[model samples]
Target chain A: MTGIDQTSLSRSTSLKLFGYHPVVIIVAVLLLFMPLIANDFILYQIFSWSFMLGIVALSLMFLAGYGGMVSLAQMTIAGFAGYMVAIFGVNGIASVSIGWPWWLAVPMALFLATLLGTITGALAVRTEGIYTIMITLAIAAAFFYFTNQNYAIFNGHTGINRVATPHFLGVEWRSTVPFYYLTLGFAVLCYWVTSWISRAPFGLALQGVRDNPRRMAALGFNVNAHRIAAYVYASFMASIGGILLVWGNGQISPGSVSVDVAIDNLIIAVVGGISRPIGAFIGALIYVVLRTFALDVLVAFGLDGNRFRLLIGIGFLAIVFFSPDGVIGLWNRWRNRHASVSTVRQGGAHG
Target chain B: MRRFIERHPLWSLFIIVVIFVFLWLVFATWPPGFEAIFGKKKVFLNAVLNGITLGGLYFLVASGFTLIFGLMRNVNLAHGSLYLFGGYMGFKTVAWTGSWLFSFVVAFVAAALLGIILQYLVFRRMEGQDLRQTLVTIGISIVLADLMLWIFGGDFYQIQTPDWLVGPAQMPFVTAIKSSGEAVYMTYPIVRLAIFAASVVIGLAMWLVLNRSKIGMIIRAGVDDKDMLSSMGVPIQLVFLLVFAFGAGLAGMAGVVGGTFQSISPGEDTRFLLASLVVVIVGGMGSIPGAALGALLIGLAEQLGSVYAPTYAVVLTFLIMVVVLAIRPQGLLAR
Candidate 1:
């Protein structure tokens, strides 16, 4: 934190007065008052979901973008946190839930999720880069199967339903606007933290390990330690996202932690662009919009409404195929083509 | 084998003890005390048999997976979709032609063709980039799964055993002694035994082809150094395509086998995919015998765990994986 980059700092400060300031201000104002312009359904179902999913994907973006580790267990970590919350906190299933308050349950969930993520990370870090994906994926699948099969704690396939959400300061946090802002607060916090971490010394070391592990090791950095630390950090961030997700849905199930959902998390991170923190939110927003409205759009096109998965898959394939960097890559390509230096400053800030 | 025993004497001794215990459990009658603790003989034998048969199916799927995805270093996440596709194709072939044998052929050809397309289109284009290839496979798997779901609907389809392969085949293992002092023998589904035998033959054949044949030498050289093999005048791409097609064909046949033993459905793709992943991870990627060993261990763990614990079967399999990963990250038999 003390050793700030002289070049980036100078450039950002120069841009503060002119370039990206107006756009940032406009986006901030629009997001702050989105509830007034959008309906309850859009606020609750669309935006909140995007914020929650964005937060989860941000965890992935941090590891993949900065640390050079692609973990499929991000959603699993989120689901584990959600499951812990439902198990520890108040729920309709008295046999499963111990009826603890949110304060007690939430921290317990975060700690346990981080612990699980750390263990998975330690094991995953035993191998090289590509194996991380396979190992994490296998772990995710194992968790899903275990949750689906075990009823004593996980409540089997039906899962823990009718879970209670937090309420305080004369505000029902689960209500439309309140919940939207709650998720927005979390999304912003996670994004800021992720962005901050990318510039931190540890993050720089991680990028070094990613780019050249042999050189990093020669430079006296513990490569495995860095990768595992990245997982620990990402998992803690993902735990927050998971708790918010459970609160948003008001339930936790094995279906929520299924393999497809895990893959969808990867898709969100990739489609948004893993290079920057904001890309997670952008990817999540696009995914949420597509999931919410693609049904009607499909029907309009005389296709099966259920074919949204195909659409998402094809779109994801296209992104991976043409724009491997996602939306950010496409934007950079466009800006470079047009030679628009001022507009490109925003992308440069993250790039 | 002798060198392995020489290097790890304790492990060799432990393996010998395990083999002896397994042989006794299979060939000898269990003591009353042992039966009391471990349940009845019939149930134990049935579970063991089921585990072995399941291992055969796993080996069928995983060997192909290990070959193309593991050995070839081609990331093919859509492998499970290929499995389901083969199963559906086999089911349709059986439903239309009523020849159970023909279904296997149809499924193999169908999956192999799909494999060829994937290899040519995807792997050929991006040979060395693991992450990009993985992402592409993920996308392909998602699209394929959705497409198959659209076509097959959500119903489970199990292949019917032919008349010749139907019914239980009695084994010599004693289950119990009747009041009349006549010993009862154990019996198992004949189709499963046949499938297990077939898988063993296929496994041995693959091992022979990989180890003893000229083509195997060429393939092994390619694995070590692709550039060298190409310079040596081998048709390396053709070899890769054939291997991929062959592996896919094997997975397709395994699907038919799976359909007979257990029903195949929509989510079965993910299940089998995970199973293969665990198997390869445990067995060591790209090693044939490792896949077989890993498959058998996972299958036995799963069946026995399901029988005994019922709730934590997955945990048992995952525990094995974690243990293997902790002890030998490259797998137990990785070269």
Candidate 2:
């Protein structure tokens, strides 16, 4: 065998044996070396925000991909968790402030957030497709205006502010490098769990329900129970994201959990490709990059920065128009094309 | 009397009327007396009038929303973007021509064209694919909103009415009495009165079209069953496109009229969008009369709510939405 051929074959075999898709392996390598290549701000913006939003979007994907429920209320859950943290800390308008340490507060907040999600999920899962979306939207709308107006409990329209980052192991988790690492660890953990669950029996059953619920029910699966469980699982991921988002922004406001934010999560998930967990991270990266950089580009052209939204809207429309499967689908198509070209070359050589 | 009462359900009717009357009397008498005794500004009447005008504008927008939702069965989340787009378009046209007549013509045509293009490009392809379409259109709406922000900036812009229709007119009864004992005339803006008239005309036109026209019959039939209509060779796609465009055009007209009455700003998109959604939910998704009635309730309620409790104005509409949904999941006028 030729020297180059031997090396290539070994590399391909190693990728297979490690059970790492080329995309995942590359991403892992990049993330491992990201600190070396990127400055602190770049790391925070690209790695941290991507991971945080990815985690949030992952929750939505779980609902959309596994449970066959497209929930717009994921942001609402995150926002709820965020508000819980602020309220429990010194910022809440309610007279009842917990003032608990991060260890207690975060867990409590996450738990409450999960319960909120489960309730929303329970209410939402009763309907399917468009109705599911509308109900979640209604719930989200209710939560939004409630937060906007309920000054006594939620601190009203301005929302609660100055929520402190959790101090874990005597380390301030909000520091750029530390936070990025913390986020990376969580993201990797969630991705692994998501992949693992998608392959598990429950995941298989959920898929069965997604593809055909009536048949799954006939086979003795409690479809509603499975769906609710999926929502609970998804809510856990979203709560984590919400917690991280609080740390990232240093505050939680009505805007954080607004209808726009809910829709933004949907856009990120759709942009990333709903088929996998990594899709959320990828989608978040794309959305954040577009949103962050598009401002600079518009400003450079002497155009108002606010118009960056217009560009994002156009980009989203185009993405939906062409690739309903999103960026992952595009990546897959490119990979498939390369695979075909290589296979054709191999056939020619053999002949 | 017992037989007549049973046949007419007089007790139930009597209770409803009595409650309504009691509520109205309490609202009318208590607020003024409290204000007079407490030496507070008797701003309640003025606020209600203002709220009515605001509600009238909302009705125009929400009626469009209800029409599209009713016929197409697609909750175009981007409807807010369209509403904002119309306002921006009207603003631009007014900027260009500097004439009210030309501005109307330009705004209407521009908005209609925009509606047609959006329908042809985005919504038409989303016919059967509901979820993706919603997501896609939301993106489009955001982009459009951002585009407007880019073009117009975040600053609020006011559409100037004609010279003849500017300013407010004098009223009689409320004006005659004040703390100073001077004649205080209740002033109403001419532009707002014109908008109300225009809306009535537009609503009448729509009612006639839907109730009378053959095309309207086809549209009603299409809404009933797109598949059944298509099977009969009724170009369902075309009908959807038309409906989407028509809805967008209405949004545009409302924006132009709304801009003249109330200032247009970047944040107006979400506010009006939510209001329109509320209207559809309250009015019953496909019912025309429901949109009008829902609009009236929303408008009056908002005015009255703000007058009585400024803090509760936002909650009032949302509370109404929740209550309506709980009572009738199909909405106030759903078929």
Candidate 3:
């Protein structure tokens, strides 16, 4: 073999053993063994909530990162799916439910959620930048109001409760271990899909559209169509996360899709790293952990637990002000600095 | 005929009025036994009056939004927070001083000071970047909202109106003709009329400033072309700062006015913000007249929708926005 071929083969082998990276194995092992070490609260509250919210943020990240469209309607779409589940599937409360099986209801909810997102995308695609934000925000506000007022389908302010999770083959999915694994599996699948799509031809085209829509259009790509398609994919992911969220909470209310929660989704994506897929997960983990513990930290200081949002808001502001690229960007910068410093030290030693 | 109609849009307005009259007549005579959901003609007139007052307040809030947004291309999502903050401050001032005028002035100055601080601290750092501006403003809004909630507590607060504007005013000209041909008069709150008057004065002052003053010219020019205006040696940044302060102060003043009639609550900040957005969107983003018209339309739609379909009152504004956007994306009076 040529010298180049031999070097590349060795590098590839060193990088991966048996087609699995060390990091992957470590992560897999941790995920599989996490329930063994952690209690129900940690597994359910921290991990499960983090995974679900991370999935939704990942959807926003995909659109904002790849498609350059920052949609505030993501939570609205997710809420719609949750509402769909409550309405279609058997719930403990509300006589309005259609009483459909989980198999039939889940797919239908997802499809309807996707359709709603696609319609919003199509409507908002004609606008640019701040206008897009406004339009999506308007849609979100409209959805919130509609759900809050229309007692016929949505059951008014107090949303449907006791939405049943999937149960089949003697497996109660809502249980701690099963639910944790289920959420973990979905989170992993979403992350993989996001990363895979980022490398896909369509995703590349969408990125190109994001960077320069006029140029992409000049190159014969349908910019609006690509954006709408991205919304579809993102909406599907958000729908899955929403369904998972409803199951996790055992209830879905108008509060679930409030303007604050919608804005929080954006915050999660931004604080993690808008342009990085893994950043969503990282950001969500931080947010969840902070929300869970910050109250305790505050109450200990003789402050109100409700002041948690103040801390979050301040942190968000500081993060945005100091590093607009978020935590992942900060990490990358630190790593680069370390690498450069070590290289300089090595050069000095050689001299 | 088409060319004549196109040339004179005012003629079309007249035609629209005629059509509206016809629709009213039809509604009055439809099915020969249809009863108005809004009770009698007196109630209908009262709803219309309420709508105008609400629209006037909306205009006061939205005008500032349009000015700042139009001039600087900055979307201050915290505009509503400033309003609520101002209202709370006004409420506190009234509680302390027992003077409505003092509270108004305090709210205005406080809101303006906060606006200046926001511009200097958060907005200045991320100039000309839309997404960053949005995120930063959202952050500020959250902080302000939480702080207000902590200080004001969770309860709703309303400002007490002055003694002079406390009673209802008789409206002799506004009467309902019943089937028995008896004329029934309507009376409106004097505070509502004062609010309407305030809106008119503010609107007129804004028009005069925007149209007749040199600074107004500079602001208008900046809105049209910022780089060009800056290159012409105008202090664009200073102008933007002033505009931002002025706009925020307007919101604060509106809050005081709104608080006198409507209760101030936690979520009202977002509500006013959304209202301003709808007004600006319907009225054409930066146009003063557009904001006025948009506010009126929203106010009317809201009142009418409430009278007819109380549950879907809020949806009417969204519907108007959607229809306007779909037909005229730039808004009704964009230029």
TM-score of each: 0.96, 0.83, 0.93
Misplaced by over 4 Å in model 3 are A1-21, A341-351, B1-4, B7-39, B172-175, B178-181
Q: Write the per-residue lDDT of candidate 3 for residues B193-273, one digit (tens) a residue.
A: 988998999999999999999988998899889999999999888998899999999999989988997989899998888
Best-to-worst order by TM-score is 1, 3, 2
Measured against the true two-chain complex, the DockQ scores of the candidates, in the order shown, are 0.68, 0.29, 0.44
- Whose lDDT is greatest here? 1
Q: Residue B148 error for model 1, in Å?
A: 0.6
Tens digits of per-residue lDDT for model 3, A1-351:
001112123333566866877777887899899999999999999999999999999999898878878899999999999999878998977577899999999999999999999988988887888878878887888788888988888888988998888899899999998999999999999999998898789988988898889999999999989999999999999999999999989899889998899989988998897767888998999999999999999999999998988998999998777767678667755655664665322111000
Clashing pairs in 3: none
TM-score of chain B of each: 0.98, 0.86, 0.91
Docking class of 2: acceptable
lDDT of candidate model 3 versus the reference: 0.86
TM-score of every candidate's chain A: 0.93, 0.90, 0.92
Tens-digit lDDT track for model 1 on A174-255? 9999999999998888887777887889988888888889999999999999999999999999999999999989998999
Task: Name model 2 segments beyond 4 Å from true.
Answer: A1-15, A18-26, A29-37, A90-98, A122-127, A134-161, A200-202, A213-229, A295-307, A337-351, B1-15, B26-52, B93-102, B163-190, B230-238
